[model samples]
Target: MQHRPTIRFHGAAGTVTGSCFAIETAGGLILVDCGMFQGSKTEKELNYRPFPFDPESVVAVVLTHAHIDHAGLLPKLARFGYRGPIYATGGTMDLCSVMLPDSAHIQEYEVEQLNRRNRRRSRVQVEPIYDATDAALVLTQFRPVRLRQWQEIAQDVRVRFWNAGHLLGSASIEMEIGQGRDLLRLLFSGDIGSGFKLLQHDPEAPAGFDYVVCESTYGGTDRLDTTDIGRRRILAQEVSTASRHRDGALIIPSFAVERTQELLADLIFLMETGDIPSCPIIIDSPLAIRATDIFEKHRDDLENGDLLVRAIRSKNVRFTQTVEQSKAVDFVRGFHIVIAASGMCEAGRIRHRLKNWLWREEGTVLLVGFQAAGTLGRILQDGAATVRIQGDEISVRANIRSIDVYSGHADGAELSSWLAGRLPVRYAVFLVHGEEEAMEAMARRAAALVGDEHVYRPRLDSAFRLDADGPVDISQAGPPPRIDPQQAGHRDWNNDYQTLLLDLQAELRNAADDKARGVVIRKIRRALEE
Candidate 1:
């Protein structure tokens, strides 16, 4: 029987958010990510849906990074009865300790508001997808693994975590699947961070993989350099201009990970050089606070910018571990800067600040990361003259500005160069995350490097089974054993391991058989010929 792995994309296919993938083999099942679904009403609705497969049966979850899109749904999985080990980097583990719980709180709050709205509209009652207790349960499953070291996930699967350079504990996973005699190396690009980023080291490409699942968030477009330090100058000028207008606060909607810290560093530098006045800078999000602490903890990872950060740390200039102080910044109202999380302004303390300052003509909201569709951040980024926040539509009087200079994900060239460096690839599966256009563009560029014949941009619920022949499908096959037409069919999953195994076995058998494989060839021919 063919011993190749059966991979399924449960989420993060068409639009970025809710990143989850499953790999099934004879030995057991391994999931790459268990992230939450974000963006749009329809997409958000998917979070309430039950797991597509048996969460309890999943052997282990290897998380690439701590980004909510890649690691947020573990609590839901845990609450649903998954007790397997959840593997992630030390930094990711720590970040999740803060992020997962915060996510649960946000969910609870959002759901409560949604239900209130539903009641007014005379709609059915709704429940939160998962709670803080569920999130706390998943924390027990996490087993932190350091970077660049190989650790066995099961009898046949060995995994090594490498710093993806996206966030503090962000990593790209290199997993070797199948038993010793029938090994297949698969690499999962969680989210490739850029090269030459501040504070964090550059992304290091893993060598030699039989199959690759890569993220194409910015793959279609080239990285736009403002040319000759223009971005830095723009940022400095913007801050200076705003400071001159009034001593009001400059609230920046930034991801708590790399973006917040990078902005802090830049702001600090501008202050030190007298480019921008010495205004009190606050890293306001608790998640960003914890992430900054992790950045301080892992100072060794700072390849070139070690001394600058160290100097700042020594001077006690960084605003970390001061939540009360962060809140207090709002009252003082001088030429101060506050960088907060929930970058999209969908949720977080940033919302409170935006609610207060956005109507003011002089205040500015500096967007420092990608904003998902439907997020408050995106609306503001698109120059929405007015937007609703917590039932009140506020005018976009604040100076809305975005500087794409500090994104954690790699730009087009960096992604292309990373892919090109990893030569002799058998097949490449492009996972279009962050944005749809980004994924399509990356696929085109990857096709250029490795030939279009070997590239695939898979959509949600698509499956790719890899073998010596190439990728095959087990997805569209009739009635997967775990899935049932009837609602409340938990029995179909709870004790149906045998059925899953048998179906997988049959698929493998059919793939191995020359006659059956020949049918697939003819089917491909008919489609191509048509």
Candidate 2:
């Protein structure tokens, strides 16, 4: 008779995306956050791999939000024969209806583009992991639950959601799994949002958890209004300056959801306050336009959004819904601010805008998000004097400015403050959605402040078994996982060498077919060597 459930960290341990966790109890098995990998190429490659746990063996999936990193790979679970319900907040479900299909379309288009490039280079064909049909299949499995309602997700595992205020419908989940006699409580902060934002309520403290897995995206930095104040000051200063100097575009690479709308709200406020001379602020992303419309519909959830709008009382916040209207923003030219999506300037209309504006002295490129390690935004943010757009390398004369105050994630101090108010805990486990250095720093802070002797930074596929009377059992038993060696900087052998080694292994197995099964050992050894 097992008394406590075992928790496993499958994803989002070492990197920012691909958040998944499994809780195994005497009653059954439960999983959380079946998300696909994003960011760098090696990270994306994880999407093609098998789940660490048996997909069919998992009982249900509890989603915290609909961000691509949190809930994107859910359809793949269904494809792999898991018949289970996916529970999330109503807002999260609604957002997924739009985002999932969009994700499918983008994936299909990306695969097609990849094939085209591969064909031109004479390479092998590959397939998109899943399509719109798979996404559609996933939609049927979603079971919407309201915030603070604890449903029995599995036989003994009960889960509840609290608003994280990061995005529309985003939540921090509190899960209790056990017989009614006793239980182990686990809290997962799903991309914890900035406590204060328009159109969404503030993130609340997740109460009563034996173990807490918090996000640490801003764990290393202090919460500063620098992003908001600085961006506003620069936009006001530069746009006013640029308006006087020449007539060119101001391109802002933004995230489609919260970031775009936040920019609009701030800029609108700035305009009404007479901080900058009023020029047309064009929100050029179609998805952003639709999301803003959705934001309007879900006004009840927004934190003082209606009152804020009424307080400012400005009517020129533009939402460009059509491509024609978006293209029209580019032609207008002088003293204009254009916010576009796929924030890293990797793809979307922002790229086109950058191609045109980067070489010009009067144009300005404002970066307003955390640029991932390999993203084009990071390159520019790091002060690359010149950057490549499409196929041409263009001079980066446009002033590059980053204001992090608009960042939705909680910063280091905010994270500490959020935890500071919580009742003193016996132990805490930090996990979900952040980079490695950030996690390590947060772990240290949490350990020192909480005075918990068992603060842990879990490795991928590692399991934690809670003890009835004492410390946890930390052991090496876990699913056999293979992370890419190249990712950690050990790669002299490329694809060709890997193929040759595999072929030789196959040939050796066939010739010694009687006892060739033993060569499986050698094959794995050779593959690891490469």
Candidate 3:
């Protein structure tokens, strides 16, 4: 008799970020996509704790894609004593070269800021979770796998990669569980894309599987904005509207990966076809510029029939690096487009760009990506009149708009199509990488498609066995899960911290005198210490 596979949901079971799944079988512990948590403080703090399983116990890591939320924590895994070959596509490995270092740099800078604040009040200093050194060290162990080809990474375990159409080198993993009479197949849809991608190909139509684990990022609602052409028109219209105002900036909050490149290609095609005026376009993200170069390195993998190539050749576009150059844009007075990263308006130079243009009625602050709840992008998208930035409330008089057609994540309809096939499952489908509302909604739909008894939404740290009894949660299993909002310690700490920050900022701003301001600042410091 052969050993059967047992799976544990370590992350991304209850939240939209931090995707890590462990499979113990064939005398090997295999991991998939060790990502860091983002969003509110409670979620972010989870990244500081040790991985639920011992890092050294894992034999190999199969990365799904290079998105920070999908692959961000690899360096941390390396730092904590995981020394194994990580597998991904060539494009993903190339991206990790720039992305990992940048992630580490951000961690170092943020930790420095935290320590500076700590030193002010004599609180114990905290260290960064990981550093650039660890990130760089992790890059030395990359093993590339070709698409649609099954490669054995462990004893009796084989995996194949399929283009997910979400990003460059994005893959939906297909795994063969065992051999002979005990064989089973499973599929992991790694961020399936809605059709009409600018660079990558359409998502692979899924095949037969004994069990499936899929991401339900946009499962709560069926999306109306669905095509690439329709989305391009919206962008052109926004730019054209901005152009009519003579000297205004159309600030686009975009991610640095495929999203930034895709927008440029569309804008270039639009400008060439005279659908929009030829305005000066500025890409202010160094990471995006570098990623664009990498995309060019793998132009054969791009879709759109050479459209992206022409976009890269356009003369109206310019790439800016350095803080001084980005600041100088503030003094420019003309109809132009500025695309910046930190797409959710959480970090990066987009905030600076927003501060410059958000007050102008002529400009447009276009959101072309998913703005998670509680993020500044979501606030703007919801039509907030003013938003606080850097402790000062800034007026948002500019036009704010969004078009979801550019989303990399497949919506509910697309997911249904991808999941609907001739495949008959022996066990169930596990949903991950979505908000609770989204997962529950998708679970209902999935149950309707693949029997209600066969759809499982496992909690974080939940375990299931793929034994002779088929895939089922045995009463005897892994640790009981401690998941989001339900986890005891610091449950409301995120909300409380946010409210405290806002209150302190208001008090400091309204303070009548320097003595009053100092007192308020001291109170803020004390509250933080407490």
Every model's Cα RMSD, please? 14.7, 10.0, 3.9
- For TM-score, candidate 2 versus 3, the one ahead is 3
Runs off by more than 4 Å, candidate 3? 474-477, 480-530
lDDT of 2 by residue, 404-455 (tens): 7677787887777766655455466565466767877787778777665657
Among the numbered candidates, top TM-score falls to 3
Query: Model 1, which residues run further than 4 Å from truth?
Result: 115-124, 179-181, 226-231, 304-330, 478-530
Clashes of each: 2, 6, 1
lDDT values for all models: 0.75, 0.73, 0.82
- Residue 162 in candidate 1, Cα distance off native in Å: 2.0
**Ranking of predictions according to lDDT:** 3, 1, 2
TM-score per candidate: 0.84, 0.84, 0.90
Question: Which segments of model 2 are wrong by more than 4 Å?
Answer: 1-4, 226-245, 307-329, 388-392, 469-475, 484-530
